[model samples]
Target: MAPSPPPPAASDAQYAQQFLNTVLSQRGPSALPYAEDVKWLIRNHLVALIDAFPSLRPRVALFNHKDGRAAHLLQADGTIPITHAGAVYNLPAVLWLPEPYPRAPPLVFLSPTPDMLIKPHHPLVDCSGLVAGAPYLRSWVFPSSNLLDLARSLSHLFGLDPPLFTRSNPPNPLPAAPSSSMLPAPSPRAPSEVVYSPRPYRFPASPQLAARPPPTEDPAEVFRRNAIAKLVDTAYAEAAALRATREAEANALFAVQAELRGRGEWVDIGVRKIAEEMEALECRLQDVTMATDVIKAWVTENHKGAADADDAEAEGAIQPADVLSRQMLDCTAADLALEDAIYALDKAVQEGSVPFDGYLRSMRALAREQFFQRVLCTKVNSAQQQAHVTRMAARAPSHYAS
Candidate 1:
């Protein structure tokens, strides 16, 4: 039974559902090569084809492969309206969706009717009616590319060149479009547009033609279809170019970010080293400040400037050692002087200015004096520090009581 027509309100929804049912009605791997989701997407693409051009409807048909294996594949039978030299011609076509579709480009064949014969040496379509080398099909990018745009391209190219010619005497029909257009391909190459030459192709005795009767095409619709085809192609081309540009920009940004991150790490290492050096400098500055304070205190306590005659300590003469600190300083000075004398004596011996025996005797006498001086320095420094600490402790209680 013929399926009832959908209501006016639910027409759009029911209309889509009907085509979906037809595409899915067939069962198993024989029907479609895609999974449930892939099949749905395929159906949508077909629906889009039918929606754009109502004449085309997708249906399942058993396709015999040239390699002898047969499977069911979806085929769209329709008249693609082509504007040839200001005249619109409805060209019958059978678009075969390959099993590896979306990933693989589909095949479109010119199905001329019984009254028509394929023109020989046609640039677009060969004797077999296989349409090839259309720019859109040859450079098809999957997912973004679909049957709808392909239809647009086919229509546009067909409009430029007619693929079939009508026969004056209706002798015999041309061979029908192959049982399938999806040929098995071992390479990434698109299906060959010119597979069979006219000489070798044995036209079957039986009528096998793919020609449609003259269509009562609407002028407005024809113009609209042609315009749409041009627009879709233009938009697709622009979109592809835009995607390439955006990808390049993104890659540049990523490279810059990586370089900046490397620079940031280097800067952080420099900052840490600078901080460590600053800490070391602060420690050395504290030691220098303490030594300066000790010199200032010594000058205040005993220094008598030569110009200040009325000063309480009038003589600038060197003071005799009075405390353990003074005694320790003198002892250290003597030790350094003896070391310099020994160094001079060794140089004199090397220069042959002093006899070896004299140099040896002088070095032994200086070494004995330096050892005693260093011992006295060690004892005086220890006693001085102890006495200073005791004086500070004794004065601390008096200050606290006051």
Candidate 2:
């Protein structure tokens, strides 16, 4: 058998050329919507058709129009029927520069009865009689999405389960034809009008009017009264149950208390061990503290020797050891203050009134404060002496000249 030739590519070149001319004619000089939208309309529809019916995957293309618009394809020949929907949908589609673009969804009324492929679910059905004409369609906007995705969503809407992880077997009710009374009287088309008449379907009945009470006497009021009585009985039962629960809890608590008392002897041994460790730590800390004090005294002596060396170097005169001793008094006082703080901290830790870490931190802070205070006082004294010397130098020259 001879192989069939490849399906023809949909051609919208003629329609696109006509559309460009029409746009130029309409605007004369100004730009209407972007020419990109024209291309997008055809492409999006074609993709959407393929997505909705995967069988049409090989048949997607563009078909030319005598006017400016184009028909996106589904057939292997890359062609759309000249007639579709109810009328000769062969009309050129004008792009509406509103919220719903290619996504606002395509209206399917223009084609003949054959073009009514399948009634799609109304994911965003507008019941308002706003866009009524033959070619008027809803504007679909999905800022982050395209028409093919929307078509897929629409296709799935009718067939999918409600997130139940299983295929649903629910029955679909058939759409009933609307009675003439259900439709509004046909209205005349106004000048420059494009959309059609009142909606063919009547508005749904109000919830208040549609809801019918059960056959029983005042079911809601009766149910409400019965519910209250049942609630009272339930509350009483719950209270009795709660009392029984509390008695059981109290019995369990008493048993736990007895068990704890039985283990008191063992707990006493643990407490004694903790106390002995604490006492030993205290003794060790005392010995270290005494050693630290001795080292601090040696540091004071070294500071005095250094001061003497500084004085001898600066003044070219060696001061007596007694004078150097007094110069080192600041260091001595700081050392004594630090030692006292350490002793107090060691005692506090031994007493266990505060944690060992807290005691050490407190002592360190106190020693630091004392050391800074002594250094600050020495700096102030040195500055004052310098100022006095400067004042004397200024007066001495005048006094000597006089």
Candidate 3:
């Protein structure tokens, strides 16, 4: 039979080149909703990936399986080959780009062959053969990360500890093969031979994976979770403290109101007592004024009689003007006492020490007494002047006859 011609190698190279060209052209003036700066950043990252991994030749394609349009990285040669459990296997990897490229980190997946088994010891590799949960990927920064750096990191990780293994098999150390030249040697299997069946490479239809959540066994993860819990507890404590303070303030306000009510009641009682005292003082002042008026009239009448007796030369009926002066003085003293009482009442009202209405009533009483006293004094003085005139006229006529 004739030898079969080698498969066309230019097909993959053409596809990769075309995909790169499409990504580069996306930065041009187009009616895409993305900003020009974002497109430019994505282009730069793609260029970096191409320069770093020329053998892989990463290509971009529209991911139509999801609800929104997104880009995915497709590479034919992007596989991690590892030797585990005395056998070699190729772990196919796929990189997925987020909708806003360069702003978010790409998701990586390691789709193993059906025959290949994966362990959970790998830091980035999940049980579902998904490579995620790395601190670098979690804290991705825009324009700072590129596909090349992530690919290189994942590739280097395999060298440290590859988790690929054969199903239901334990790893056994291989014995050294001795070289013999004298006898015919049996053929040995190639060390680089893949132990598993090959299958067509394809990206995951859906990005969702059955990978477990980040393990809490990790010390860093535990510390982060505890810190968050502590913060929540602290916030609750602060809120409780604020509530207590508000309650205390409300209680204090109630206490102050109660005290003010008590004080107001006491002030009312004091005002009532002061009003009663003022009424009594007003009555006393009126009595004193009336007595003063009576005394003044009696003094004027007695003085008139004394003047008449002296004019008629009746020795027994004549009394000295000194007695009338003494009576007037007593009347004046009574009036002074009434004025003092009025002054004290007015001061108390002005000072707000007593109720104004009660004090005003007392003042009215004193005013009436003052008016009556003034009228009585005026009438008594007029009577004395008339009696004096009569006595002087009698004396003058007698002197003229002499």
Candidate 4:
């Protein structure tokens, strides 16, 4: 046999007395206990409270908790006072002590509460945020409190009168649904007018009672149950279909986003390539400008040297070949510029960045004309120098007499 169960722990009366004592020590005269506890379990808790917080003497009272959830009952009528909030009143409180007293807090909660409120769609009744949940208990520190005070605080939020009718006014005509042949009809009574009729009372001679048979289920009910099952199955199917539709729509949106990302990447790559080509063209243009400047300096030197040589020879001048070289150097500036324009046209065409065909044609024509004119000017200068050289040579022979 299982070991005899340990002797029962302290009784409810003991627990009640301990709780009262704890409260009285803290609140003194402000403390109150249920009338049953006051008469049956008169511990020092109430007396101590009366002496400590004298003000509570008038307001505090022991009340009953049978009709509704109340921690204290009024001594005058044994009426349990309803709390203001979280209509639950059967809060089970006990004296708490730590491994060493006054360390950890006390554990407290209502005795028979359900956890229905933990459901996802639980409805709210009033302003207080109290909720029903698993095991359904609230904790309170005891060196600081007791059950009666807790009841008073909760009563302020969602309290209902003992009858649960607002302010003792009960609803007169109970709400009823319109008759749909769901209830049995009441039997009609026969009218009576006899004045001295004996009220017959029937007494069974031997009081023999017959046993009645248990009721049986009808075949129609089984069919109705089957119909309900089919309806539920159809509803579940519809819900599953709706879920599938939503999932498909989400997938379609993701696919669209992926396509857009791919297009964006291609656009970025194209833009980068165009930028690189433009930079290269700019660098080539800089080189052309520097070459032009170098050619200009060479032209200046050649022109000065030829002019000095002409002065020293009097009627003679530099040779045609020398003049041609000087002119070519001077014209190199135009050649360099024409070369730059050709390169610009080719770059613009390849990149397709410069959209104007008219602009391209005008630039090309300008380069061609400038370069061709520079060449013509060099030729003319060469011809003039040749004539001067021939004349100078003919005259110079007299001085040497050769």
Q: lDDT of all the models against the reference?
A: 0.68, 0.41, 0.55, 0.40
Off by over 4 Å in 4: 1-231, 300-402
Best-to-worst TM-score order: 1, 3, 4, 2
Clashing pairs in 3: none
How do the residues 1-402 of candidate 3 rate in per-residue lDDT, one tens digit apiece?
Answer: 111222345555444444444544443332233445675566556556655654343533333333433323322235644442233435566565555566777766664544455766765577755566544465455566677777665554453356554444433534433322211111242332211112333422221112323223567755765575455446645655666587689999999999999999999999999999999999999999999999999999899888887878865554548544545555566677888988898789889988988888888888888777666666666666777887887878566757
TM-score of each: 0.46, 0.19, 0.33, 0.21
lDDT for each residue of candidate 2 in 120-213, tens digit (9 for 90 to 100): 3322222321112211122233343353453343223222211111112323543433312212112232222221112222222212211234
C-alpha RMSD of each candidate structure in angstroms: 18.4, 28.8, 25.3, 26.3
Ranking 1 against 3 by lDDT, winner: 1
Candidate 2 Cα outliers beyond 4 Å, as residue runs = 1-143, 158-402
Best by TM-score: 1
Worst 10 residues of 2 by lDDT: 158-167
Question: What TM-score does candidate 3 reach?
Answer: 0.33
Per-residue lDDT tens digits for candidate 1, residues 1-402, read 112233345544355557466545556543456556577778778888878876665554555566777655677766787776566677778787767887788888876667777888875677777887565776676678899998987887777556776665677645434344343222122232212111222222322223446567788987886686566657756766776688689989999999999999999999999999999999999999999999999888765664365564555455655677668768978988998898888899999999999988888889888989998988888888888888888878776757
| Candidate 4 per-residue C-alpha lDDT over 1-402 given as tens digits, one digit per residue, 9 for 90 to 100 | 011112335543443344444433333333333232233223343334333322122111222223433232111001123442222332211121112222222222221112111112322121111222211112333244433443343333223211122112323544332222111111121121111112221211211111223246466865764465455445545654665587689889999999999999999999999999999999999999999999999999899989888788984544435655667655776677777877787788678767678666777687778868676877866786787888788788676756
Give the least accurate 10-residue stretch of model 4, judged by summed lDDT.
189-198
Q: Which is the better candidate, 2 or 3, if ranked by TM-score?
A: 3
